[model samples]
Target: MEVVKELKVPIDYLFDVFEQSIQSDILAQTGKKLNENEFTGFEYVKDFSKGNQATIQIEKYERNRAYYYSTHTDKNKISVRYDVHSLDEETSKLHYSEEIISNGFLQKMNDALVGLVWGFLKKKRFKEMLNQIEQSYTE
Candidate 1:
């Protein structure tokens, strides 16, 4: 389950907007929709690290950075890695690939379906989040 999306904004304002988006409550809302009760944050630390025990939390956001995190699946203990890459200063690409531990056709199908639904939700949520950020600049 690999989902990718790209968004373009002004190069000069991109970092500012991106930083604000990450620090804002909008990210928390997105996290709630993406992860579960067990892991619901944008950053994982040494003390709070879930290790390789199947976490569903987002990684820390470095300045002008990209990150990947493995999080528990919504249905099972299976975990998936969400990878993102910041392209240029104005564009960014996101990839949410569902990691399949089991090599079964059924498992693949399940993961694909989950990815589809998650992808749809992500696009909607990201668009809404961006809109909110833009609105804030005006206010």
Candidate 2:
């Protein structure tokens, strides 16, 4: 999945907001602290509901420009990337993409069917979150 959006905030601000969000989420989920200065190649395990867990790795980290990561689970490997471009002094473009690879035939089939049903909802929610971020920054 891929999404692109124009944000009403500078690239630096957007990147900082995104980094803080990720750090807080990781800390909440895994009880781990992330050092922003050494974010690249950082790895941690995050626990989910129902005792599920996944290993998350920071694959690429470029301040104010790009952040890419991968999550490895027993059933799937998921990669996500966020790229930010400055359009002007107070505007930026954000490009987001996500890919998932299933480890087995059944999981692949299930993922396809579930993605067909839930993909739009997920995208909508993500866009809403971005909008909220922009609104907060602008205010």
Candidate 3:
């Protein structure tokens, strides 16, 4: 599943929100208490390093692109990739792609159903995020 959001703010601001959301998710999902650079399971690879973990790893990130992966196992996995495009100094386009894979006949069906629900919820969260971004900048 892919969703595109055009923001009135600059690409830099979008990336700021994106990074914060992912970092927050990492802490939430892992259920571990640690600093940003410290993690019990999550590892961040920035420029030259390669990701080898099977679950919860930042595949890569640069100024305008970021790819993230999280999986319970080979049977259940999801990847979200972000590619940011600048329309001007104050406008940007965000391209997001999400892939959810589940093994077993029953699991696949269940994942599909869950994905459907999550898609709507994801959109709502995005709206809140954008609004929050605007509010934060305004204050």
Which candidate wins on lDDT?
2
Best by TM-score: 2
Q: Please list the residue runs of candidate 1 whose C-alpha ends up more than 4 Å from where it truly belongs after superposition.
A: 1-54, 57-60, 73-104
lDDT of 2 by residue, 29-124 (tens): 778888776778988898889999999898888988899999999999999999889999999999999999999999999999999999999999
Best-to-worst ranking by TM-score? 2, 3, 1
Clashes of each: 2, 0, 0
TM-score between model 3 and native = 0.67
lDDT for every model? 0.49, 0.90, 0.67
Report the Cα lDDT for candidate 1. Answer: 0.49
Q: Which scores better on lDDT, 1 or 3? A: 3
* Model 3 lDDT per residue over 33-78, tens place: 5443443245542222363444566665665555455554556677
Q: Which stretches of candidate 3 lie over 4 Å from their true place?
A: 21-54
Off by over 4 Å in 2: 29-32
Please give, for residues 1-139, the per-residue lDDT of candidate 1 as tens digits.
Answer: 4556564643334446644543453344443332222223453322224533333454433334433344454334444444455677656565545554645678778767876778678667756765565455556
